[model samples]
Target: MKVAVLGLDCATPQLVFDQFKSDLPNLSRLMAEGIYGELESTHPPITVPAWSCMMSSRDPGELGCYGFRNRKDHSYNGYSLANALAVQEPLVWDYLQEQGLRSILLGVPQTYPPRPILGEMVTCFLTPSTQSEYTYPAALKDEIERISGGYILDVENFRTDNKQAILDQIFEMTRRRFRVAKHLIAHHPWDFFMMVEMGVDRIHHGFWKYFDREHPKYEPGNPFENAMREYYQFVDQEIGEILSLLGQDCAVMVVSDHGAKKMVGGICINEWLMKQGYLRLKEAPSKPTPFSKVEIDWDHTLAWGEGGYYGRLFLNVKGREPRGQIEPGDYEKVRDRLIADIQAIEDPAGRGIGSIAMRPEELYRATRGIPPDLIVYFGNLDWRSVGSVGYGAVHTFDNDTGPDDANHAQHGIFILQVPGRTGGHNHDDLRVYDVAPTILDLFGVSISREMQGKIIR
Candidate 1:
């Protein structure tokens, strides 16, 4: 059977299955004729690792990708962006290719530096620019540019205050992506096809506050209250067009890397560490500054953290890091202490924020590469982790990087429709890893012993 997977980045279950269900008729119809539910995302629920985890049936630790960026080694300069080269795990399409089946991959994350496959390939948003070779055959880039009239890798500067420009860019990008997808489906030879649309994620991060009443910055009678809803409808219409092109034997699945929720604020992790006496610096900045730009006194610091949607804390163990302070014997002692302290943290109102911290070894089947000492969800992901120092207070509403209004949730939405099967069923226990196995099963491919998820059936 042919398989088509539609990936919507950061697509929240609430909007897909509940809040905007009536507006998303294409998705609503899919729900009535297919199995649908929330798909549990990876530990940190960030884009880079979550999509990699879903396609490879591996956890972030096994993939060795903690977030968008990872530390290459113990050195301070070891930090690098996670790309196609960083991941070595075999994906579902890799297994399919071994069986002599052709597959089409479009905009799948971590696909930049596009590798050769049995069929066509278009890299993900990580592609530096059109100047770079973004397509596998090299000539496909010209075809795509001709058909789509110019393609956008991703929305640039999505976190800016100018809402109109951001909205326009998002729509234009989505239009081009869908246009390219339809063109590929009509002309390419394929047994499996997959495309991920990033506009869902970009719009949520850019316009969530205006639509979500639970947002801290929500206002009554805003001009953009219906902005998110309109985008969903537009995406649904695009889905309908694609659905009409698929054959009767095609098995379709829709998924997201993670869900999106209103961000209450940010917890300046470096500032909090300084307050708790775990991190020491040579000199403090008068204003907020990135942690990487500051001079750290590694001899005195016990631990440090890198922040994004979640927090990654690294311990300064002797012999592991240069001028490390904590001895080898004190590694667990220091990690456990920091975990306890980070979890016990309270919000600005003095109420417990329900923060959670865990060791990387505790979450994955096997740890690979340079894993973080601790993975944390500040306020259970209601608040983002801020890596900047000199924020004065532990809590701040302003994002260090830009004006992001939302943070990722632990559960993303999923929908599966198998050919020649009874329709309508809700599978509530689905996980991101389960996707790879299910697709393999549909195509009669053997599930590898190394794969960590069960088939949905």
Candidate 2:
């Protein structure tokens, strides 16, 4: 069967069906005709590993990528920021190509420096610039630029103070992305086609405050209050247009890597670690310094956290790190202690923070590179971890990147439809990893033995 997959980053089932069902006719129609549900995302759900997990049908451990920024090795001082090149496993598309089935991939994260495929490829957000060779065939670059004016890898400077400018860029980027996608759909020959629209994620991050009534900084009558809804509607319309391009026999699926939600605030994890005597600095700076810049007193430091949507705590194990402190036999002892302490942390309001801590090995089949001793979700994903020291207080109002209104939620969207099929169903137990195996099953491709997720069928 011909399959067309649309990846909508951060598209949540709650927002799509409960909040804006009426505004999304195309999606609503698909829901009525197909299997729809909440697709559970990866633990500490963020973009980098989430998408990679979906594409590979493997958890972060098997993928060996935990986040956008990864420890380069077992060395504590070295790290490598993830790009498309960082994924070590064979992607689903690679499997399809091996089977002699042609496919076209566009804007899928972890696809930058586009690998050679049986068909066309256009890289996603991780691409450094449009000037780089973003397409697989090399010549497809000129064709994409000619069709969409220029290929938009992603909107730059998403954290700008100018909300309107960010919105405008989102619109332009969405328009270009869909335009290119449409051109490819109509022109390219393929058994499988997939593309991801990052604008949905971008707009949510940029304007969630205006859309979310419960947001602390929300203004009820703001001009951009309907911005997120309007963008989803625009996306729905684009979906309809793409649907019209496909034949009736084709199968269609719409999925998201992870969902989005309002970010309450940030918890300064490093400061908390310091207060708990687990971390130390050479000299306290007058201002906050990044993790890399902070002169860490490793001799005294037992654990340190690197901040993101979730917190990552690394233990200075005696043999693993350069200046290790925690004894090899005490690894589990230190880890369990840190987990207990972090979980017991309370907010300034004298309330439990609702944190969840897990070792990387517990969640994945296998782990590589420098895995965090503990992965933490403060306030159950509402509050991000802030690594900067010298913030003085445990709570902060702004993200390290800038004024981000939302954080990654644990559930994204999953909708599947076969033309002429009726009696649709909804499930809450589906997961991101299930998508790859389901797609493979639909196309008669054998599921990989290494995949942890079961085929939805």
Candidate 3:
């Protein structure tokens, strides 16, 4: 049986399986006629490493890709994009290709700088633009453009107050992406096909406040209140159309990298570190400044952190970093104290927000490639980690990057429908790692010993 994966980035189980269930006929049908449940996301659960982890059945530690940006080495400024180049492990398609099977990949995260595949490929949003070689055969770029009438890599400036423009751009981008997918499925030869629609993620981040009453910034009776529901309905329609193009022999699976939840506020991690004396600056900035641009006093600083949906705290240990402050022998001792202090952090009202800091070695099977000293989830990920300093306080409703209302949740939706199989069975043990092994199992390929997840069956 052939496998087809429909990836909906940031598709929340709460919304898909509960809130908007009736509106999403296609998705509901799949859930009713298949195995469906919440799939646990990777630790930190952002798109880049999460999707990469799902495709390779490898933990972020094994891939050495903790987030969208990773410490290239021990140097302060030595960070690199967690792009396709960072992933050396073979993905599901790679294993299938070895058995002379062809696969189609479209807009899957971390696939930028599209490498040579045995089948056709269209890279993800990380592509510089269509101007770059985003297709495997190079010549396929023109055909893709012609078929989709100028493909869209991503919605530009999605984090904007201009909700209408971003929403329109998102719909158009999704429409074009699915249009291209339909063309490929009908015209191209393939055994396994996977395409990720980014609109779900974009819509949630851009408009969650309007719909979610739980959002701190939420305003009831807003114009865009139904924006997320409408988008999900559209996506379901698109999925229905795509299903029409597939033969009965094909098995379908819908998955997301992670779910979405209302973001209460931002935790200025660097500013908090400064207050804790873990991070020291050469001079106080007159205004908010990015952590990378600020003058850091490495000699006095014990730890500094970079922020996103999660926090990556790096310790400056003697003999490890230039002008390192923490003694090599005291690394774990200092880290333990910091972890305790971080988890003890409270809300403005002095109530605990349930923050926790974890050591890399404790979470992953193996620590690889300059892993952060501690991984943090501020307020259990209800709050984002703001890297900008000079914020004056630990919590801010305003985002350092831009306006965003949602944060990634720990569980994403997963639905699998196999031909000639019983439907409506739900399993709760799904993990991002299981996807790769399940794909290999579907194709009758041997599960590699290096893969960290078990087959879903």
**TM-scores of all models?**
0.99, 0.98, 0.99
Prediction 3 global C-alpha lDDT: 0.92
User: How big is the positional error of residue 29 in model 2, measured in Å on the Cα after superposition?
Assistant: 0.6
Q: Between the candidate structures 1 and 2, which one is better when assessed by lDDT?
A: 1
Q: List the residue pairs that clash in candidate 3.
A: none
Off by over 4 Å in 1: none
lDDT of 2 by residue, 193-294 (tens): 999999999998899999898888899899999999999999999999999998887899999999989899999999999898999999887787787787
lDDT of 3 at 414: 91
Tens-digit per-residue lDDT, 339-368, candidate 3:
999999888999999999998888899767
* Top candidate (lDDT): 1
* Higher-scoring candidate on TM-score, 2 or 3: 3
Clashing residue pairs in candidate 2 are: none
